[model samples]
Target: MNSLIYRALVELIQGLAVLMVIAYVMTRIPSFGDLLNRRLSLTHRVILGLVFGLMSIFGTLSSVDIFGGLANFRDLGPAIAGLLAGPVAGGMAGLIGGAHRYSLGGLTAEPCSVATFLAGLIGGFFYLCKKGRPIRIREVTAVMAGITLLHVLVITPLMLGLSNEIRQILKAVLLPMLLVNCAGVALFFFILQNLHRERLNEAEKHRIDSELRIAREIQMGMLPAPSRTGDPRYAVHAVLKPAKEVGGDLYHFFVRDENRICLAVGDVAGKGISASLHMAITQKLLKALAQSGEEPAGLLERLNRELCDGNETMTFVTLLVAFIDLRSGEAVLGNGGHNPPYWIRRGDVSRLVLEPGLALGIREQAVYTNQRLCLKPGDTLFLYTDGVTEAMNAHKELFGDDRLKTALLRVREKDPEAICRGIMEDLAHFVGQSEPSDDITMLVLRLESKEDAAAGAADGC
Candidate 1:
């Protein structure tokens, strides 16, 4: 073996072995294990990603110069991020590491950057393949081994377009890098597996479940009760099903100024507690803004600004708002990165044409425009979250928009209550025995005739 290869391999192995020992000790510490066992908040999760990114930076800065090219563990941070935080955070760590590597110009800079990014991305892809469960050792080993292969096959070869330089670089660093990364990942995960196991306390689990149940109750309580709206000139029926104990889907209705009825539905960027909290904030801001009697477009603008203000988590919500004239049934609708609603007009279903605004909290300066339409008696306006159309079945199929349109046409002649129930029934049947993949929400609005209102009253709509 060449002296350079021998030195690189020995140094890398020593460094990685020390790192593994330190990590193992940290996990063995009760305080550190306690911290690890706690459920991470959004801020903590973001910090975790940043920590991994920092690790990537460290890997680059501490690289060993072998002849001309540097042998580095730069991709390790991103790969670990992918294993722990899923795709987005893993990809972010890769970008951070890649950006730093690119800043330091070298023959291998571009390929190393690409290799680092893929390491994180592919690691995350494997993490998601397990569907939110703890990944098996085989998968982790496979990811680590794959990273080693990527470094040798792609990163080393692409260091120089010339074969002589590429071969020299590969001979020096390829095997060392592979050996350290694969062994390091296995040892690190061996420590982490214990931490994951320590979090399985039944009492702690029950406490979390109880808290989530209370939160779900409070969230459900915040939704509008159509029966309490005081005006029955129009009929509105809505449904919401969260994929978790708490979800980020929103649907609300309120009688504004005794004439206009504001109907709205929204979906936050993600699900679970963080998203649920974000939805609550959006709901409060929305209700407060809508009470000022603003038009749908203007209301969204104000809501967007409010959401963007001091938003550290960078969460976003896609909303659709409609203000309907109680007497004339004239409706003005505005959208922000949400699924465009379908207008069911007696036997015909049409997707409404509206300016698709950006989701709120994305940017403070987003513009919004309104689309106007009239709802005649017997015509129903249907609004929903993506969960309805993207609902999955046991066979890994989505209940797509085509199915939604077809299903709507079949029940177009029914009342708002019946229409809501019928579509939900179809969705449930289509998704039988399969886990819900997301938060689902649906709202139906109809301009009720006098006879229709009387029937609605009797049916407790």
Candidate 2:
């Protein structure tokens, strides 16, 4: 009796390991996992039922003998199959496993097989009423314990003829079987719940990543195309590098009329998708106001009013708008809590001082003023967000105003594109191995006399 009990325990443990492997295969394979869904077709459910039934048959064949009957952990696969896949699958698994047990031709075969079938039926009834709610461990354990008790009682009548042997088998094996099956079912579900949750998390992450990629492309497309302009007097170039998958920095330029070109550089506070959305709103408002031919100061004031009306987030934007007269080298610029822009003339670089005001969306009736600057032939104007000066290095040192001024001096007299490229290279070289913490936006515009422009065109400059 002691040896038989030990063998039954060994079988239970081995069957548990096999169940784990089967669970892994079901979870790792997409098609098999789908078979466990409540909405599966009848045909697919039957197939899954057959698979679990075979698993139970394997368990029964691997079981140990006790008196006139087998002591097997065959109850686990069918009961769990029914709980997971509903009544039909569970019932089918029970039938298959019970038939296999009966084939061994034991005195208790009929009663054992009946108990197995009833176990599947009971489990299936529990699953039917679950209504997609999670099956708790305590609930499963209770149900499995009831089934084991029923199994023990059902075989008692068949063992009436062999009373003394029945007493020994029941005393030795019944309690162990009851404990093993109950614990096994609970353990299987605990593992299944964890694996299911992990797969869901991974799927959510992949979905968000894909959406962000599409959003990045859409945000980039919103920027004005630098190649669309054919204005001779204005040579313009701009670059924006986001610190994250998406950013708040924006640069837009458009030729308003034959002799006027409007451009704006903006930095929306905060970062990532929220900031990017506000940046888009700012650009749209600015473009609409720009079309009205408002001067820099007027345009900035109007934009500020619009942004403040529904500003629930309390977010603000630092903006610089400049309208240049292509024919006269005259530029009217406005500043809204933005960084000072640099004016590069001939081979010298200097900062263009402007009257500062509160950032947009900060005050309801904030006023702004325009500053005037005259661009000389072959003169380039550089504009940037605070990200350029505040960029950090490996040593936590900032790429300050001094470094930016010096870099511009090196690229003086170059075309707008070359000037922008040189500044970026210098910034990159200075900040090696340091991750960017903000969005970097830069724009360079060069004005030239009609004769110099014509000459440069002839020389491919």
Candidate 3:
């Protein structure tokens, strides 16, 4: 009886080994290749089935001593097959292997084979469920407990009814096998958890990048292009350099009529899509008011009222709007919580000092003040957003208002295009290979009187 049981156990183990090999081969097939593709859904199912099949074979073969008269059924391959195959596969392997053993050899000594097969099946299930995720300490403990109970209730009782020597040998071998499978399962679980986390992080980064691209497109569309102008004496040049895909800075120049030029620059309160949307709305409102023959201060006041009427978020904007009369060379300027602009006359730079009022979108009844400046021949006005002064260097020092004023003095004689380019170049160099911290905007208006230039420098003296 002992020889037959041992032979049967060995045959069962061989059958399980064949099934493990079959699973590995099937995984290589394209249709089933995905199962072997690491942490995939089908991979988990295949691994589980392989483990159960191995366990069943191991238990069955051990019951019928098929090999040459040997009574020892000690083999690591079958248990290892279970460990690698995961829970479902391991359980099925165990069941099939156990049944084969019982059929080959009569139920002699004890029916411990049934219990051993069930333990293998349960272990396989636990491993399958936790294939791609982390395994907690509790999970390890639970698996160990289940394996121990199955062995004690089924295998131990049957072995106890057999000879003392047989029982003692089986006890020594089974304990070591259980320990090996438990350790393997715990290690694999930890590895799977880390992989899952890495995949999630990569996905999140891609989503953020996609959103930024969309925001950049909308922001660009809100600004006026160089080709939009129709006047000859009044030339306008503006540029926007965003530190990110979308930024808070904005500038627009439009000819409201043949004799009047309406221009405005603003900086929104935040960055990205939200700021860009606010900039679009502000530009539209200002253009509408200017086209209706409203004065600079009146336009700003109306814009503030519209912005603050029901807005509870308190998101505000710093703005500067100037209406230039081409025939008279006079400009009416409105200030709304923004930096003072520079007026350049014959290569000399001076600040246009005016009392700045509250920012737009803050108080519903806010008032704005206007200042007037007459543009003589060869005179220019430069308007900008705060991005110019807020640029940061490698040492984290801000290129503040003082530096900006100095840059303007250095480039006052250049044409409007050159002036805009020179200021941007100086800012980039000052930053010294550091990333820009905000959006940079610059608008330069050079008003040249047609009569003065045609009279061979009328004011040359």
- Stretches of candidate 3 above 4 Å error? 1-145, 148-191, 226-230, 452-461
Ranking by lDDT: 2, 1, 3
Which parts of model 1 have CA positions greater than 4 angstroms off?
1-200, 226-230, 451-461
**Model 2 score (lDDT):** 0.82
**Candidate 2 residue spans exceeding 4 A from truth:** 1-18, 37-43, 57-72, 99-110, 125-142, 155-168, 171-176, 190-218, 241-245, 291-294, 349-356, 365-367, 387-414, 418-436, 452-461
TM-scores of the models, in the given order?
A: 0.55, 0.78, 0.68
lDDT of 3 by residue, 287-345 (tens): 88777778889999999998887778788999999988776677899988987788988
Q: Identify the candidate with maximal TM-score.
A: 2
What is the C-alpha local distance difference test score of candidate 1? 0.82
Query: Where's the lowest-lDDT run of ten residues in candidate 2?
Result: 452-461
